[model samples]
Structure formats: C-alpha cells, structure tokens
Target: MKKILILFLSIVIFSCKKEEKGFSDYLRSLDTLVLPQKFSLNSTMNSSNKYDSILFKKYKHRWTYAPYGIAFNNERIVGIIEYSIADNGLAPFLITFDNNGNKIDSLNILGNSSFGMKGQTLESAILDTNLKLVVIDSSKSWQVDIDANKIPNTTKLRVSTTIYKIQKNGKIKKIK
Candidate 1:
C-alpha cells in the first residue's frame, strides 16, 4: 500500500513539472539569417510568432518586438530584434547569448530620431560576413527662416558612420 501511495505522489509531481526552453531551443526555432544583409527603417522582414512570444516573455518591454534574424558562431548566438512604438520608426537591436542561453549583451544598431520639416535624419545598417555592423546616418537641418513663400531654407548636412564588431564571447564592441 505504501509503495502504491508513493508511486501516485511521484507521478503527480512529475506530471506537473513544466518544460523549460533554453537558448539553443530558441535559436533552433528561428530561421537561418543570410549574411551581408541590410536593414533600414522601412525594411520589411518575416517574423515568427513563437520566437516573438519567447522574447517578449523573457524581456518585457512596452514597445512591440519582432524577431528579425538569427546567426551563430562557435561561441555565441546573435539575434536581431526590431522594436517600435507609436510615432517612432522601427529600430533594430543585436542581442547576444552564450551557449547555455544566458544573455551577454545587447546593442541598438541605429540612432533614433524624429524627422520633420526643420530637420530629418536617415539611418541604415549593414551586417557583413565578418560579424561587422556598419551604421550610416545622414542628417539635414536648416534654419527656420521662412521666406516670403513660407518655405524653410536648407542650411546644413551632416553624415556619420559607426562600426560594431561582435566578439567571440558574445560581447558587442563598438569599433568605430
């Protein structure tokens, strides 16, 4: 009788245990992302609902999150997530994880700004085979001197570039 009771309790306990997903599971769930890809504010990419659910549950943020791509090397897994809120354009982020599913670091791949008549900023990013991310930002701003026709004058233009490299240990380092 004691053996039967113990067996019943064991069965109940084991049956109620939930399965936890690890980083590899999440990585496997994503489609392989081709390298030498480009991303911009207007770029469109397909996403997985399951991956999005996992990301959202793990890291809660007010902005809507979409998984863009996945890539891995010998030491780490890199995932790109695009997040956006109302009025703000889409932005890409690079998140790195260790072999055991631990998050090592995250970086926003582009600069965020509001574009308008007075000033406008355009940003784009390119990921290469060497795990280098190059971001280019072009901005134009003009003095608000309205002419007789109520048109703003163009005064200045600025362009900047930033480079980032993914280290073997899953750390994102800004190289330039």
Candidate 2:
C-alpha cells in the first residue's frame, strides 16, 4: 500500500510541472497577440534621450488586423511586422523583453523612413552575422477602375522591395 501511494504521488508531482514557452513558441503565437502601437524608450536609452512616439497601422485609410512576421534573437529582442492589404503597406515594430518574458519596450519601426520598412508586408526577419536585425519587405499593388470593375489596361503595377537592418538601440538603418 505504501509503495503504491508513493508511486502515485511521484506521478502527480511530475505531471504538475508547467512547460515554459520558448521564443519559437511566441513567434508561432503572434497572430493571436495584439501588438502595442506605441512604446516608451528602453532604460538604457531613456536616461539620455527621454523619447516617446505614437505609431499607427492603416491601409487604404482604414484600420485592419494584420500579422506579418516575427524575429527573435533568443535573448532580449523580438521584432514583428504587420501588413494591411487594401493597397499595400507594412507596420513594423520591435519588442524587447527579459528572459522571463517581461516586456521591456515596443518600438515602432514603420514610422522611420530610414528603416525602409513601409509600403510592404514584411516577408521574413532574422539575425544576421553581425547580430543586427535583418528584415525583408515586399509588396504588390495594382490600379483598378471602379467604373469598369477591372484593372485598367494602362495602369501599371507597382512592386517595392526593401531590406533593412535595425541597430541594438532600436534605431533602424536602411541596408538596401
């Protein structure tokens, strides 16, 4: 009887252990997370700059739900880009957190022209050899005639491509 009881308790204790979510798990769950539109400066930068910014996500003058892509460094930073499809545009933002998933900051990248992350849906994000955040932006736009209900014969299609690198301090520097 004691042996059986001990075995049952051991099983219960092992089953009760919670599984921790990793960075990859967070990336897979991005579609369900509502990203913050604005962010305060990080502590390291806040003391020197005292900066604040408001960000926006809109396509064709209307607000929409867009989940594009996410990238993580497995340590401190995660960047995500959401895109709107009415015409074509991207809203990229950076999220910083501690090892315990405590949010540090959510800095907007789409607002910065130097980031070159606007006007396209982010395709992919990865950390490069230099540990800089590298992202690829792509989009396709076509002009249509409302009266004809078809694309205009003379209308030209527009495609934009941008590759960007984000620095460690949350500032974006255009790469291509």
Candidate 3:
C-alpha cells in the first residue's frame, strides 16, 4: 500500500510540473511567431490545444481554440486565435496579452453567416504592419415571391468597411 501511494503521488507531482513548464514554453514560442502582411483564417491549419484550458476557461466544451499568429510591440503581445464551436466554421479573434501571458483584451476579426431564406453575410479582415486592422463585410439579400413558388425577385448587395487599431497598451480601438 505504501509503495502504491508513493507512485501515485510522484506521478501527480511530475504532471503538475510538466504543465507549468509547458505553459511558459508556449508563451516564449509566441514571441518568435512570424505573421504575414495579410492573413486569412485557414480552418485546415494545424492547431495546438495546450492553451485551451487557460484561454477558453469560460467557453463551452464544444469550442476549440487555435493560435493563428502573434505580434509583439514594446508593451504587449498581440495574437490571433481562431475559435470554432462544435463543427461550425472557424472565427478569428485578435487577442492582446501582457508580457507575462495575461489576457488584456480581444476583438473578433471576422464572422461569416448564411441565412437560408433571408440573406447571407461574409466578413474578412486585413492586418497591416502598423497594427491597423480593416474588416470588410459584404451581405446579400433577395426578395422571394411566395406566390411564385418562392422564386427570387430582387436582390440587394451591400458592403461596408470598419477599421481598428491595436494600441501598445493591449487595447483595441475602433478607428472607423
């Protein structure tokens, strides 16, 4: 009985130490991440679930997080993390963290949706070197004539653009 208890305690202690080291190593790796001038969220890209426990603490069990890219300024670390709920498509978010790996703020980068009978909307974002983010949203809706066997009558397409700035202090500000 004594030997069995000792073995179990040893395993638990070693596992805890490994988890602590993994978290710090992960944060250091973020500093070396290379980001492109224009990046679109790719759902097929490989993802790490190591930080899911830390980052998605309050999220539902069906949600998953994937780190897209990371940028470093003098004061903060900006990272793009993609989230997916269940089997739904991925959505990217720009999350800011302090130097010690504490989350400061976050903003959704893009979200696309399709309305079966009403309309559909698509969104995308581009991040420039100066920490400027531009989000473009395009939507389309059509009028359906129920009397005509639900045939489409008229369609309207709308496009809009919004801009945001990620400041050095880990804050996201909407500039447009």
Residue 68's lDDT within candidate 1 is: 61
> Candidate 2 versus the native: TM-score?
0.34
lDDT of 2 by residue, 1-176 (tens): 99999999999999999885454454554542232222212111111121111112211112323434444444555554443322223434555444444445554443332212122233444444453544443443344466534454543334344455555644456676
Best of the candidates, lDDT: 1
Clashes in each model (backbone N, CA, C under 3 Å)? 0, 0, 0
lDDT of each: 0.69, 0.41, 0.60
* lDDT for model 3: 0.60
Q: Looking at model 3, report the run of 10 residues with the lowest lDDT sum.
A: 55-64
- Which should have the higher TM-score, number 2 or number 3? 3
Question: Lowest-scoring 10 consecutive residues by lDDT in candidate 2?
Answer: 43-52
Best by TM-score: 1
In model 3, the runs with Cα more than 4 Å from the true position are 1-19, 29-33, 37-44, 48-63, 85-88, 112-114, 147-153
Which digits, one per residue and each the tens of the lDDT, describe model 3 over residues 62-87? Answer: 33355544554454464545455322
Query: What are the root-mean-square deviations of the candidates from the true structure over C-alphas?
Result: 2.9, 14.6, 6.0
Looking at candidate 2, what is the lDDT of residue 79?
Answer: 51
